[model samples]
Target: MGQRVAYYRRRRGYSQAVLSGLVGRSEEWLSQIERGARDIDRLSTILEVAKALRIVPQRLLPGPFHTTPRQTQQSGTIGTAPDVVPDIETAMLRYDGIAGLVGITDPGPVNLGHLERQVELSFVCSQTEQWSRMAPLVPGMIADSYHASRQAVTDAEKRRAKTLEALVYRVTSGMLDRLGEPRLPWVAAERSMAAAEMTEDPLLIAGGAWRLAVVLRHSGRLTESTDVPTAAADALRRDDRNATPEHLSVYGSLMLKGAVGAASVNDHSAVRDYLSEVERTAERLGSDRNDFWFAFGPTNVSIHRVWLALELGDPSQAIDLADAVPLDQLPPELAERRVSHLITVAWAYYLRRRYREALDALTEARMAAPEQLIFTGRVHTMLSGMLRRERRSIKHDLRELSEFVGVAG
Candidate 1:
């Protein structure tokens, strides 16, 4: 990675100082990075360097991301998806966008209400980390929701159906992202945004933007991800004078997404600004709430602080922040968030070389949401990293975790 950075810097005719200044780093830091004496710990920092060098982030990425790792390799591609992913992908691609124009045939009269209920149920299942129950229903939901959206008999029903379709697409995008199947999640996010637009609902549209931002960040479109959600957040602010709880919920959630994106690119100012705004928004909302399944509130804001701290390469700060979070107060529907926080804690522990604590946190996360573990890329990557540097005392437990997350030990 250092060698690639040095090569690109020279190719661009950038002196070390110029490149370092561009990324807000000192000349010595840049020199050390180029000499392989210092590591760029955060992907965001790498992205900043890549942008300064005017190359795709992948060009600066190490080989592990490009190919499967052999034994003892610390980094690499997130492995394959489960069998269910292909079926979900097929359902997503099979829709021709002419479904509304063509109408439904086999399913008889489209039950928009029933379809809405089922979509809501699927979201609940997903939020609660019930992957096995949610996974099988998704393909059908996508197909049927499209049909219902196109076949709506009235403006009210049309809005309702379109909203359902948008939510379904959001769910699908999230599932694909969690499963580490990248490309289709973008498609699903795009479809979600389109479906949301048809409804002309600000909240739903904002929700779509949030989903797209998440997918964009995961795909390494870090800057665009932040811009997307920030735009949505601005739109919401402009359109509402007296924001309701739902409005604030979605707004705060967008701010949170923007904060994460900003952190990913090492934009410290942007991250601080976004977090400050979100903290204020969370305070206005008074407590934790799951409006539109965002799970945005005070607790969620603190959770983001921990995550953003970690993203900024401050493992100690992240661990300190994690200690103060009120995890026991998390709603049962927010099992997904709880699991994610646990993983973040595990990451913090791992970074601090507290191997036993990391393993214990990961174990707690898996125990909290076992089915969700297989779909998460972090679990696989971290397990592989731990396996590469395993201590004899925890070797057996670590291997067990690697097996659980399907990483070869």
Candidate 2:
């Protein structure tokens, strides 16, 4: 561990003093860390060091030390390896049809109806926050969809197959992102865009762009995230035929993504413009609706406003907006969305030093989606920090949360 730290530090052109200062440690302490004389054992310190070095925590750790555990067959237990992530990566990268062509495997007959149903189930599982059920389904979905696209005979069949494949990849990317597997999600997003382009449907293409833009935003490519979706939304607007609710939902969702990306970079002006566009679309739609699983509607728009306020450092505004947004009113299919909003609300409370409210919100989120909550890196980090700073009055409750989220108190 020390040697790896030393290597990355030097590679990043950061001297011992600079690196030590960055992590709030002394030069000698950093040297000891780099020379095997001392150990950096705490998860928070490891995270700090990794952040200063601009690398993942896994890179600094010796073995498979993912901060978030992937779901295993067992309902509540955490696993060490996060095996499902690697399996999904292998399945997506292998493109199993090649093995079938080489006589190593059999690519079965294409079944568009079955594939479509499976895709729908995956989306439902994701939205409902069933990580255990949804994750195990992804590898088979990816491999089977790829094989189906290959075996498709007619042009129409091929397009249908490709659309299913793209949707599968898009959902897979989102799941992987939530699982804290950084690189594989980008691969899935790229595959989604590539598959969508082959179908020549602008709506499908825009959906792909939306997925890619979201992944980019999470990956910290804020400029490209905002620009890509903005361009796609503009193209959709120029064509009068693309103004259907389905297309408009996707367009509005893209604008939401742009708003998030803009807020992340502190571009308040861009955020307002993008949000105005989203509001216009939401007003046209009349009420909350989930078209194309984009979940673009007035309630969804309000949720984004809370997130945007939080991102822009206005915790008071975020909390106020969150209070008005009735997450319980959201349909069962939007469970993930609801829990995610709860997390943002918790963050707002945390920022305002209202630890009890933050803990209550997180507790509510855990009750709704324990597996998903445990796998969120931001939640883990926040809980860890809370454990460090929480008052003695709330120490027991905060510690319980720390344990639940797999963070050391």
Report lDDT (CA) for all predictions. 0.81, 0.80
- After superposing candidate 1, which stretches have Cα over 4 Å from the reference? 1-41, 45-81, 98-106
lDDT of 2 at 40: 54
Clash count of each predicted structure: 2, 0
Q: What's the alpha carbon RMSD for model 2? A: 5.6
Instruction: Report the error of model 2 at residue 347, Å.
Output: 0.8
lDDT of 2 by residue, 1-409 (tens): 7889999999999999999999999999998777655555344467678889999766874432254554444355443325577888778767743565555464668667887888999899778677666777788888788788878889998999999989999999888877767588788898999999999999889989998997776665667988999899898889746478887788899889889888876789989998998999989877788877888888899999999998887889999998788776688778888889999888888767788898899988877777667777667646865775768888888887787677886
Query: CA lDDT of 207 in candidate 1?
Result: 98
**TM-score for each model:** 0.82, 0.83
**Worst lDDT 10-window in candidate 1:** 63-72
The true-versus-predicted C-alpha distance at residue 7 of model 1, in Å, is 16
Give the Cα-based TM-score of candidate 2 against the true structure: 0.83
- Candidate 1 local lDDT, 303-377, one digit each (tens): 889999999888999999998999988987798999899988888888788889989998888766765566665
